[model samples]
Target: METTREGAKKIAHDSTVQSLNQLLEKNYDAENGYKNALTETKSAQLKPYFTKQAARRSRNANELYKAIRNLNATPVEKGSAKAAVHRTWLDLKTAVVGKNDESILKECTRGDITAVNEYEKVLNDPEYLLDSKGMIRQQLHNIQISLKTIRKLKDIVD
Candidate 1:
């Protein structure tokens, strides 16, 4: 008994939910990546920075989760499998070769780039609801700030 317009609306809502979920997953990945960097880095100066970034990513992920729930969608709690593997590799490399702050910063920068790209995709998609754009824009700005910080640190150390 759904009209065509109703079905279209449903599709748009579903797409928005899916995009939000993807963004949430990226936030989870960033959170884990920052945590790995914090634990693996030997630099005292960088450890606190990584810790703060990790906490920020965690907060962002929780915010995304709440947003998705508000849209009546289930939010995934765990990061992607590829993210877990990447973290494991980083940990093993650190254990074998020793901690390098530059390398950690580079990896963190890559994760930030991914996060920014994910946010952009959602923000640019017309299927995404207008009401959600404000949150997405703010989160994107935060990720961009983190990216800039990582790049600056990498430049300083390299």
Candidate 2:
């Protein structure tokens, strides 16, 4: 009968939708469960790294502060700018070395770039007449190249 055929079609459509809904629900549950597991796993993996990194960064910050203070005290002598930039590089290097999340190094390098920019402004100023401005600029370009390399490393690690 036509009524029976229509009823059968209705039932098939309902069955398909219900099946699809069940599949979707299962997928969502699986994703949520996996996300929770991943969070716990990552937390456990990261704790020791976090502890070491904090101590290292603290020491590096102290060194950086001392370098900056020394630079401030010295007369703006020839090659001082280059030396100061080198000191900044050392600070950045110290902070980032052996870090598990290499992105931390990239971020510190980015901050180094900012510090370089600040130093560059001094070199650019008419009154500053920073010694070895060209050398300092070249060193900053070198730092940029290092940052690119570090970024590549971060991509691979991540």
In model 1, the runs with Cα more than 4 Å from the true position are none
Compared with the true structure, the alpha-carbon lDDT of candidate 2 equals: 0.41
Q: Tell me the lDDT of model 2 at 9.
A: 61
Error of 2 at 148 (Å): 1.6
Question: For candidate 1, what is the lDDT?
Answer: 0.86
Per-residue lDDT of candidate 1, residues 1-158 (tens digit): 99999998898889988998888888888888888778778788888898898898888888889988998889987889998897888778877987788888988888888888888988889877887889889989988988888888888788
- The lDDT for every candidate, in the order shown, is 0.86, 0.41
TM of each candidate vs. truth: 0.94, 0.34
Error of 2 at 64 (Å): 14
Candidate with top TM-score is 1
lDDT of each residue in 45-115, candidate 2, tens digit only: 44443344334333333433333333343221122343446445645765677333444445444544554
At residue 46, what lDDT does model 2 achieve?
Answer: 41
Candidate 2 regions exceeding 4 Å error are: 1-99
Residue-pair clash count for candidate 1 = 0
